[model samples]
Target: MIRITKSIISIFLLLSCFTTVVRAADFKPLPQWMKTAVFYQIYPQSFKDTNGDGIGDIQGIIEKLDYVKWLGCNVIWLNPCFESAFQDAGYDVINFYKVAHRYGTNDDLKRLFDEAHKRKMKVCLDLVAGHTSIESSWFKASQKNEKNAYSDRYIWTNDSTIKPEKFVSGKFERNGTYMKNFFDCQPALNYGYGQPDPKCPWEEPVTAEGPQSTRKELMNIMDYWMEMGCDGFRVDMAGSLVKKDPDLKETTNLWAEIRTHFQDKFPEGILLAEWGKPQQAIKVGFMMDFIIHLRNSGYDTMFFNKTGTYRRDTCYFDIKGNGSPDFFIKNLTTQLCAAGNDGYICIPTANHDFQRPCCGERNTVPQLKTVMTFLMNLPGIPLVYYGDEIGMRFIDGLPNKEGSQLTKGNRAGSRTPMQWDSSDNAGFSSGNNSSLYLPIDPSASRPTVEQEKKDPSSLLLFTKELIALRGKYAALGNRGEIKFLQSKDNQYPLIYERRLGKEAFIIVINPSGKDVSVSLDYDRVVQKVFPVLNSSKHKIIDYKNKQLKISAEPLSYGIFQIY
Candidate 1:
């Protein structure tokens, strides 16, 4: 018995070593453009209105391409513009082949890709792969009483009476009940279950014909767009495809297949997953994934903790300075180690689903600038949501539109129309207030692009300056190596070194309302001070005895080059 146990241990050790070696060797180089790519996320319905119909459209996006380029973003992550029922925003896709009529035609979308590429920029469309609108033609054919090609396109129970969890029945004519992904309007596609139970005869294996057909259709849809100049996709709910995928083994394999297909056809096309788990997402073949507002991912702990998500109001960037970077740092290191050079972890200022950096207590320019400094200096790709660059406030109590109200919170606040200028509808549209898609910020002091563009010290200009600084130095870009140089006890006045070859820069941040100082080891450096971003006063107090002392004022940050 002892001998058998010893043999088992040996086998386990061998397998662990083999797994490590496989992971180390499996990483493929990311696209050349992705290394320095900065993404600008645009919610199409809120960006701009070309014909003054009150809803932002593809032509509007086309007209604003120059503005996007001017903002120093080389990639545009456009939210779903597909045909939809306007339920759950544009997430409940009705047709993958057509753009929503309210937005424009497919030709207009094609033109958007053309225009973006002409400006040396790329556009990534939002791909909602997990589910489709109940109004979709595929779902319509699937719900028919007779068996047809699309009869099994979506998941359905064996009998109408056998209603499983999250199942919807009695509305469709089909004899079997169907499963929903989120809302009643969105039905889950048949990607098949990772673990099919023998007792549940309705559960289909991943190798089933229905799932294979669905995979083929997904490939066809992607090919259709890529053939027409579309760059890539930001796959929504990427990990939510296969059912019962607790380990995500089957789901990863599914994406691996898709990755293989894309590599052969459109080698330069990228795939950014909304998986949130960077470790698993990178292994699943996504070029990038988000460190989003998941339970323990530490995103909320760093920025806005309005709902007490993770650690509550004690955000790392809060003026209170009550939050610690330990949680965020741990998660970040784990993901970075897993990713290595394979993929990037995108950290956005704010997305459509959450409050921007300028919301709530972090409304002041000094506070916003500190947050921007930390985010922009980080090692991975930086994503700036539409109005976040201009410090747009997240308005509360707005009426829900297109299913913006959810269990998480009312997303309508973040989905408000962009405040471009002081014109009618804030230059978003020429339509009357009643005809507008959503109400504009009623605050007279609400920041606008026009007003901020004229102010050199405005947050909008600061954001642009930060992006340009990032572009100016290789050590500040996405793939640069970063080393934290702060002392162990105090996490305030966060200090870090970004070095690539001979190019090195030290960045310091003090988010609290009170001043803070930190001592760092600088044995190998000569001090020649040049401030790249000094939002508030930052000074090198002393450089004596091989220890460099630096102090920053309240809510201030600075980037210094070491000579």
Candidate 2:
């Protein structure tokens, strides 16, 4: 009987072990789409190029799949890879089905999609449905005749009237025959078309008004891409879809309809909207993100000194335009509770189409990492930009005295080149040196993926480790109830605590010349503490007499687990 009982007990233990491993892999922390998703945005041309075309291609991305997976990112949000006339990145889509010959062929795209899925990572293509290249087949056909079947696919008004001086829409303008353009060279679509082109069903409006037209057009689009096995979309200018001529309410409704259709079809797919307005976007079930600058309130901001960090306000209750540390703590707590169901506040350090933070502005890695920790671990969802893992190279003023290429301080500046190795062209392309579109950064201190892999504390490794840590705790990611610890810190350091039910965390940041002492007595909720990652300038000293004291190197952050 004893031997039989022992065998049964051993079998039960085996089953328990198997279940634990499976649970970790099948961690469905968030709702259908977001659980276990770490999205990495790619600026294609700057990511890599092959065949000496001086432009990035689909094949270039395939070569770097291992590097992407190594970063622990399981979701890829690629910037536009469609055919275009090279204006405003690739927001202007020329062909929806075919891969741009310049980028590669259909076979290359198929291969890329296949490889991406094989690595257990999902791929989301940029869908610029709002407008198309004026050179697109449908647009060309529509422009041929005023009453063409494809004429009403876009928001076009052919009054031949010159635009008003300093009018409402300030995107861009061409001649007196100006069509509404988010940028120059992009003509707005006409409101309602009688029929759609044979190739494009979205060429014509379904009804006279835009609401019904948008519904039909967006549904058709969702059907095509989902059928092609796309995971979802990082929709471009989603807020601009409804057009301001009729006000944003109509546009916001269009988004709600668009979001619902995709959500119903690809229930487990991701949808990250680039809408700047969070209040309106969440209504339609979308995640809104920042451009380059992260919404921040550093303790250093309060100091009237060399450091530029903002000092937090005295009261933590108000969520207005107050950029205070206490304000951050309190408001973040409110966001944790409310923002998830309403809309997700995606805080990112920088993206491809924006100014690089490192251009001429000197801030240590610790200072940068501290900010990263604060943003990524906050209650709401965290969106990481492409090169933000490592300090990226930056160029200043479009017209510089150094004769280097001048970026518009918009998308062009950050869309330079990927520093993979210290190679001649940063391993971006194999073409001849002069054939390159953008010049390689010349600094020797440029951080490369190869070099960063060897260093555990490298910005790349640190980001990866931190991201993985977030995955470990379901409470840390998405949004939940958060509470900031009580403290009277007069510019000593930005210290606070975060709580989600029984789960609680402490955040401390030191962006100054001297180290400061951290005390648990500031809050009555002190218990045992365990340290997460901190910048090189900081260390976790022993908890002595209810006080944690250490010499924090400037621009440092500390994340602690309290039990």
Task: Give me the candidate number with maximum TM-score.
Answer: 1
TM-score of each: 0.94, 0.76
Full-model lDDT for every candidate: 0.84, 0.57
lDDT of 1 by residue, 405-513 (tens): 7775777778778888766655554555333355564556788888899998898999999999889999999988888777668788888889899888888888888
Clashes of each: 0, 15
Clashing pairs for predicted structure model 1, backbone only: none
**TM-score, structure 2 vs. true:** 0.76
Flag regions of model 1 displaced more than 4 Å.
1-28, 307-311, 428-437, 441-443, 522-524, 537-541
lDDT (10s digit) by residue, model 2, range 1-563: 99999999999888865653343233222244464566777877777776676677788888988788887777777888877765656767677766777788767876787898888877888877667776778666555444555655555333334343322222223212334446544655543333434443333443455436545766686677666667877877666554433334445445555656666666666666776545444544564443222233222232212111211232111112122455444444443344455445655555664444343333446545665665566655566666777766454333321112223233454566777777755655456532333555455567777778898777788788778777777657654345554364544456665666777666666655465565554433456777765555345544556665544455667777777
